[model samples]
Target chain A: MKPDAPVLQTSGLSIGYAGTALYEHLELKLFPGTLTCLLGLNGSGKSTLLRTLCRLQPALGGQIELLGKPLQRYSPQALAQTVGVVLTKKHYAGDLTAYDLVALGRHPHTGFFGSLRSSDRALIEQALEAVGMASASSHRLARLSDGERQKIMIAKAIAQQCPIIMLDEPTAFLDVISRIETLMLLRKLAREHQRAILLSTHDVEHAIRTVDTFWMLRRGCRPVCGTPEDLILGGAMASLFEKNGFTFDPLSEHRAIAEHARPVGIEGDPAIAVWVNNALIRTGRKPSPIAPSYPCINCMGKNRFTVGMPNGACKNVSSVSELLTLLHEAESMPAQPILPRYA
Target chain B: MRAGLYPILVVLMLLLFAACLVYGSVFIPFDAVIKILAGKAVERTAWQSIVLQSRLPQAATAVLAGSALAVSGLLLQTFFRNPLAGPSILGISDGANLGVAAVILLAGNPGQYFLGGYWAVIPAAFAGAGGVMALIIYFSAKVRNSVMLLIIGIMIGYLASSAISVLNYYATADRVHSYVMWGMGNFSSISLERLPLFAVCTVVGLAFSVMLIKPLNALLLGETYAANLGVNVRSVRMQILLCTGFLAAVTTAFCGPVSFIGLAVPHVARLLLGSSNHRQLLPVTLLAGACVALLCNLLMVVPGAGTVLPLNAVTPWVGAPIIIYVIASKKHIHYFNEA
Candidate 1:
């Protein structure tokens, strides 16, 4: 195989179960040293497509080439040496330490008994370090948190030493920090190790930030694949969630609900105004540049804010909490302004 | 820790084997038993005959039967991914029981059927068990869900049990009494003449189980992951069914449905080793099963009494508490490392 050849490629591929096609005639390629994210809603055939590529499920139609060889021609063991997978299903490791679990990834390379040699052990250790799970190597999987377990699973895949790695919803059950960390780790693994890494995730914001390529899957529509920028600029992201009452916002690279609250004007520093707008939107009040009749928040400076009410009563606040409190308190007052004697 | 535990378990098994030989309905001195085993002249001919004919075969049967059943149980549990799954859960034992029931109740003069010295019940049991296994294997292909396969197995067990009840209703009084005795189970039933056949079958089944350790370990992660790891999931599942079926069937044939050891010994091994890697777990389970069975056999031979207790009656006493403890302290037991 040429060094620059794609590690995984599918042409005119169809995927589904038992002759029922969820996707048809798909053309895709995963190159080495690149991270590709498959973005889709639930039941959008992302997992089905991944399963087909990994050969866990047979392709309903078309051809898949692994390292320029026909995928079907490779035996299961031979395929295993080339492609490693981290499934979404939680495993019953059963009192196995993180090290033991990761060592199992060397099974294809190890002999029939799966006895790990010194080199295999070194790979296991390196894999653990790659996922930042080296410290927890001795700990039983039961003792680890979900995120830690997920990282350990990824380490297992890394220890397999495959050029292509595929994961299904790897960050689904993780917290925000762990999710970002897992994605960042995959991105690094792809670039540094020059492995073709493909992961399916609902986290579009992170995918947009980290992935070199994107495969957008939508129900009843052919999957569209391109660079993240092309997809966003081509307005494909916006249409991706159009049927689900969600609009993809290019600026945030996140999907937003179509229904939004009425806007309230705010005059503030650009940085603070962004946060202020976020706070207002979270409270069901949209931030606008102008809403003269409604209460407008005027940012005096950092950490200082003044609410200018329609009735001419100006209230001083020091924090976002105080600002929200003043806003809520002002909501119950009469609409007519009570003119102050000094004013 | 597990490395240390293995030697301790092996020593314990040896000690129990010695106890099974020395302590029986007829108490033979330890030295005399050793002499008898060594093919030396013993003090008395009866003692020699008792040691060689009864206790020796009984001990050997206990070891093989116990190991076979335990390994069978382990295979089923891993295949189903349910800790509670056992050798009998898949209806193989019930199928054996149904076969025995047909012979003892439907066949006239059960004594005459056994008078030829070759037990027809053994072949009958093997056939019935094999039949159920074939049916299960057929269904296994049709039903991809493990839980559903488990339910189907349980329903098949129920069907076999109902058939056994019908046979019991028509059996003669004496035949029913003998059948009930057989159902209680006994390691002494395999005489010196039949021990060789029992040993060969059990050893082959166990060897097959040893070969399955890799795929069995993969199965711990569930079928999909196992497949991704290059395991031929369908072939492995079939192998497990075949091995478990043959082991459970042969053991049930020779020693009437030896209970508790099959269902409980794997848990004991898991607790002992604090791991479930089948490479270590399988050997430990086999040795532990032998130890537990020999212990039960020793307990059955009540001191100062000529009569021995039923094997099943004594088994639950040792087995039930372990199972109860396992169930009660499930959260504390790291049977599976789950997040």
Candidate 2:
């Protein structure tokens, strides 16, 4: 649990699939007792990174060291006892109960011919309870929903008693509530169990709130590693999206498509044009007949309300940055604002 | 440790052993038969030899062959992770049949065929069985999944059967009849002379299976997990194939290829034990199979007066239903562990 003790390390690593290189010349270290999240676009190498670290998939180059020794040096059994993986689910051929599947975690602990001891059973039950699946222990896997199935898979990994656990896209198939709950459980595991937990997720908000390290894979090369705050402050958030219509929003940490990006001019008289422009931007359609009765608009700079294009064609205003600055100033006054849905 | 299973097996074996003694063309007195078995002088000479030699060994062969085949079946089913896998599934029995056919028909001299006389069939059948095992082991290693390996085995069996058909086509009429009779399967085909080899192979095969008990228990979690638990998947696989093939070849060589017991007895054993852990399942399967075979041998006896029926005919009646029940039952299906 020491900060310097490495749970998993890759040196000069290159990983690929079916002979095509995904990444090369990569060096990374995952520390114990911390939850790390990998954030990336759809085709980014998050899964490849996790797989290569665990040695599940063959690393195309370099070596993976676990506890200061080469990964392949450990026997499969010994390595399995140290690291537990919750892989994406596929076909599991049986009517095994949740408890029965979880009990399989004890396989690495028991003797080749040994019976399940009391300790093994206790661990299985505890893991079941860890995921809030204690009462549903007897339910067959065939009867469980997607959320419940994810919990069972996680519970099984917990029972394995490994010091390091890694998951790939664990929240991909979950609903919003289940996604939050899964991240919370993982956070608890990182804190209480003192196990290094690494997970890949596309849910940006959950990753920001729950994880200790955000491995941002924005540039599609060697991932940039830092705290969530560092990632946002370093302008890494701005390049997260490459699509033609969208741009990353710093304040909300979201993607948005810009419209009516006209700049306001003729400020003066206590920035009256800025105030009216801010009001128009709020409705996103146009200002609801800018209240002529309001004194805020009394000191108008333009010739009796210089009419501009409603569609934000910028028939008058030059740049959208000016309009955004005005809105930022007005929004700071009193009312707590609501961001747009797409933004 | 169930009170019911062991007693049932014991009683069935005993009743069948008793019935075999009293059964023959002529009515032999029960008291006289018992006295003869105990070394009391019998008044009749021909009947004495028939009871002591023909009937006793036939009954013994039935038990031995049945137990070996059933245990082999259980091991293969578990190894392949398929309910349908058995000795025949891998073409081990077909290879034995081909060996027997080559000796009886295709070979120039009938004496050289079983060569060294009746002693030759064991080595001949073993070599044939060994060939088939090599194919199965090759397939198991190359194929990643259990079901795919199973299909590979089926294809191998088809090739063996086809090879057998060609041999049958070219064989002379008299040799063809012998081959056909061997195909029908009969325990009485094992004479008193070959009993020692049969017993030896069965014991050796059974002993080899004991080494697998630990790996078998680990396998219930599936192969990758089993390997993760330090079980060497390839070595264990090789050992299973050799043991299962040897047991089947010896039985098929000596007793005309007994059927169904291997495929069915394991299910009954699993149902009785209620756990797939091989430590419990293996012994129960061997014992259950022996008892079933012994009982069938007893049934073939017409109770104090009749000729013995072929064991193959009686085994199917006992075996086929259990197999059907295992396959057709949807609720209790379990996939055996494979690495």
Candidate 3:
């Protein structure tokens, strides 16, 4: 019960089903006040591991201790009181109001009739407030969008008042904005509420940017757990999906860039040069400082770019779209002097 | 809204109950019926008999059968997470039918030895329904998918029905005729002497359902989420099966395979309450079921037309439209999705 003690710990754990193990001899820890993301390729046992840790599924050969008690030793009610889980299953929330759904999180805490007491009601409202969904308390779930429903679900978990919280791909069906919002919410809960939060998601970029720790899983390999930077620098992220011919380059932009490009030299403000480099790569041209003989695009420091032609003609464009059009026109007519597409 | 609606439902149920007593084929006056019910003497003793022995018991049967069937339907629908699931849809009533068929057609008149034929048929119906319920529960454990479990229940019902068909095909013509008559369903089948047993059985089944309000509400979130909420999913499923099984069996034993009430009434309650929280939904469904059943009973006697329509015939008129509305407006209902 010490403040600094890890709320959840696993040692020599093996997880799987039907007598086969997906992972074996694994060691993991989740401390209070930190967020951990379980990242893995599909069918790489991310769900199996999470389900096992939550005691939804049994572990193959290891012990999971939550709050200093072995997971198997806790009954379902006791486990519910200690660990709150938000599964990825699409439950029927259509008939429940936002308040009703959040109140369901008090299942283990309520009386047999499930009548909420004064304290329980306050907790439900506070939980809804925490997720910024207090205003939607009386609205039926069918009226809300998927993102709103997801927030309500998180509110349900928060109302559970457990020391540890776990979610399974909570952002899977959410839009980008909601995804970031949910991640930020989880991070905030971990830091401010001092709860140990864990989630499994395929959103690798967001996971790296938001989570405090990563549990990277790959088939036939022991899970590698560490801070995001440590894992990235150690090349564990790269090896996760290496077998599928997918490479994870932390330094490169997440969007795919062309392999073959016409080299161009650029010199300008560093801020403008960065976007100019993006524009050149997107237009199938490589921007480099030393390629002085190639057609050079000069960055003019305020969303302006000057394309210098080999024939000593120059054209300036104000926006990236105009720059792309000018680059395309210039590339299509290399034998002619570059026309000023955008004055 | 619930506060206003519940009182309205109670009043409607009372009106229907009064209407059932006053407007039967005999056409007893409302005042005389009230006087007879209040234990006052009436001029025509036959009028007293008709009011007390006949319409009173019939109305009470309708109330019990309606609530029992409706609550059974609600439990199955919530357990399966399918709006279409109900006692008849899952073949549980057919199991009862097959049981009664075996007892009446095959048992060679156990009524003669048991003082009344129902003494054997009631238990037989429970056994047959319980057998099918056990089969459905077994398959539910084996199959994780609700739709699949539902299909298996239907298949099991078909098997029981085929067995009943064979029994019908070879039985004596008189026995076959009686079995067919029972199959049409009648609320007047239970006499005043037998009403207490029926009431007790239905009440027990309903009590079980009441005890399940919390778990039933949890189940609306689907089994995994319910389990995460510390609900013992396996035990709850078993309890639901037992409760629905007992309710379906008891009603089917006395009323024949009463149609549509079990399948359609929960949706009526849901639509009326505009929510599926079982604490509210279960009681509202019970009251709505009784109201519909009483209304159907009143509609059965065409006000001295001298022809009493069968209960099953009257139920579809009330139950089918609601079901059709539910299907046509499936998106608006937002009950549950197959996925």
Ranked candidates, highest lDDT first: 3, 1, 2
Question: What lDDT score belongs to each candidate, Candidate 1 first?
Answer: 0.85, 0.73, 0.86
- Candidate 2's residue-wise lDDT over A1-343, tens digit each? 4577888888888887878878887877888878999888877888877877766668898988887788889886787787777765443424456876787677678775546799999999999999999999987666677788788878978998888888888998789999999999999998998888889988887788889998777434567888887877786755565443444445432433244332223333445544554544443422223332211222234333333322222223333444444445543544323223213
Q: lDDT per residue, candidate 1, A167-230, as tens digits?
A: 9999998999999999999999999999999999998878888899999999888888899999
Pick the DockQ winner. 1
Please give the range of 10 consecutive residues that has the lowest summed lDDT in model 2 chain A. Answer: A290-299
| Pairs clashing within candidate 3 | none
Please identify model 1 stretches exceeding 4 Å from their true place.
Answer: A252-257, A264-267, A285-298, A306-317, A321-343, B112-119
Instruction: For model 1, name the residue pairs that clash.
Output: A94-B337
Query: How well does candidate 3 score on lDDT at residue A170?
Result: 95
For B84-201, candidate 2 gives per-residue lDDT tens digits of 8888767899888777777777762443334343665667788788888888788788887888887887787788788888988998877787677667777776667767777888
- Report the TM-score of candidate 2, chain B only: 0.92
Q: What lDDT does model 3 reach?
A: 0.86
**Better candidate number, 1 or 2, judged by DockQ:** 1
* DockQ of all models, two decimals each: 0.66, 0.17, 0.57
What's the TM for model 3?
A: 0.92
